[model samples]
Target: MNDIRLYAIGEVARRTGLSVSAIRFYSDEGIVAPADVTAAGHRLYDVHAIARLEFVGTLRELDAGLDDIRRLLEGRVTLSDLATAHLSRLDDQARRIRSRRAVLRTIARQHTEAEQVILMHKLAGMSDDERDRLFDDFWNEISEGLEVSPEFLGLMRNGRLVLPDEPATEQLEAWIELANLLQDAGFRREVKEALHETFSSPGAAIMTSTEMVGVFERGGAILVRAQEAQRSGAPADSPLGREIAGLYSAHMGEITEIPDSPEYRAKLAADVLGIEQMYLESLEEAATSTDPYTRYQSLVAIIDGTAREAAEFMPFAWLSSALKAVASLKDS
Candidate 1:
């Protein structure tokens, strides 16, 4: 005891690089009590107490709470335990920060409205299950009382968008946009009409889900061919284009069991063209951004991790032009 060297609070503060009041505060808090007190009521600390103050200062610098530091100092919690808890907290904070960053970036890039900024923040922070539920409401709304087969409706429901666990900013933006589209009344009505048209057509009652899928699969292939032809500088009236159009018309005829005759082709062509125009007009009335279909499809692809460069809607556009040419009997 006589050999022990004790220092005043000022010397301890100098040694530990902590402020004198901070050392006093910790001492008062019983986190690092001083070793001795003079008759004058001045605080004095030994080497061990000064070292403990240094430890407290380090933990404080790391943002460890006072209670946690006290518990650690008291042997109530291990350093490893405190570190684990803090790491988890940090991870959660990082996700929130990332979400906020995504929202801010979207607002800046899209010139988002004040109301939409609130919406984007809410949507960007949604859990996977919550996001799934949003789409569930959409599927239920669109499929309710529709004559579409269960299998077809199942296909629609199964195409739910899934964001990655740690989604990128673009993925978050896509999700927000998609969520907005899903909730848009105009978009909902448009999808319902499309579903009704495709599944409630004349011959649809006789077509099995497999048959419908086959027809669409075939149409998709023809669409691919039309796009290829377009890329190769082939006009919509080119021989290859006409061939693609004929295949598409035949498939359309299958939808209604109408024979692939010239009159049927002309009517289908006119109807397709008219519907495209009507769709665009309706989207405008709905206050949709430019080419909402393409944007919607692209956002879905991005969220689902299947994003590709072919979201331009060019396949259908090319096919539409070909259908028009075939209707006019202009197979150049």
Candidate 2:
């Protein structure tokens, strides 16, 4: 009868592979009760105790604390409820892991403990309202004195600061930088005032925020030639030069003019070169600044319209998202 398999605490630990102290801990916590006690008060157990210990180990690995484990062992909480909470926690941990990975990618090297702390705090702390407030401050500063439409005001109102989910290192770094920029009140106010000034100042960029009833055309002959070269494998110099020249041509079409003439081509070349000057200035402002609104406005002015443009500029994904928000609120 003794060799057949009822085991003592030491035997249970040996077979289940739990340490003696851990088994004792579980017993004390009421997670794994003794199957029986000896006449001398030693904990004697049968094989059923081994099964209970196995269940205890499974719950602990899932981060189920002792109280929850005991509740489960006593049949107080359903397995379904436990599983749901455990999975949710795992998903949250995965998101944090991804954010950390992004910080690592941005640094392009290993991070110090201090960097980890700062990066995590910035990337993880803000709620959506907080992020929106940062953008609000920027637009108010930039649109100062400008005759922006209510529609345009709405655009600024609806701008959302998008932080990446499963962030890459670059995204995490960008997020940290963005958060720090938003913290300064004076900087945001300055951004709004500057934006108001830009919209008031210029030949373009402020063309009704959607300058239309104006022509919409692509760059002419030069652009065509450049596009052809892309197919012909010509030196990128000639080809890219043509494409760059096309930008002004496209604007000309939008403005109801076509710059197909050689003289116009020369002017277009000058204009493109002019764009470089703005780019340089924008680079300087962004690098030396602490205001998100200002950085975004500069980015909008310097960058071209493309996929990359949406990320840096005002949230140009359009009224659709905001419109959706309004619709949702109205219906609710």
Please give the CA lDDT of all the candidate structures. Answer: 0.77, 0.56
What is the alpha-carbon lDDT of model 1 when measured against the actual structure?
A: 0.77
> 193-223, model 2: which lDDT tens digit per residue?
6666666766535554543212222333333
For model 2, which pairs clash? 102-168, 102-169, 106-169, 141-192, 141-193, 142-191, 142-192, 142-193, 142-195, 142-196
Residues 102-152, model 1: lDDT tens digits: 888888888678999999899988988998898888878777778756765
Candidate 2, residue 330: lDDT: 17
* Whole-model alpha-carbon lDDT for candidate 2: 0.56
User: Total clashing residue pairs per candidate?
Assistant: 0, 10
10 residues in a row with least lDDT, candidate 1: 283-292
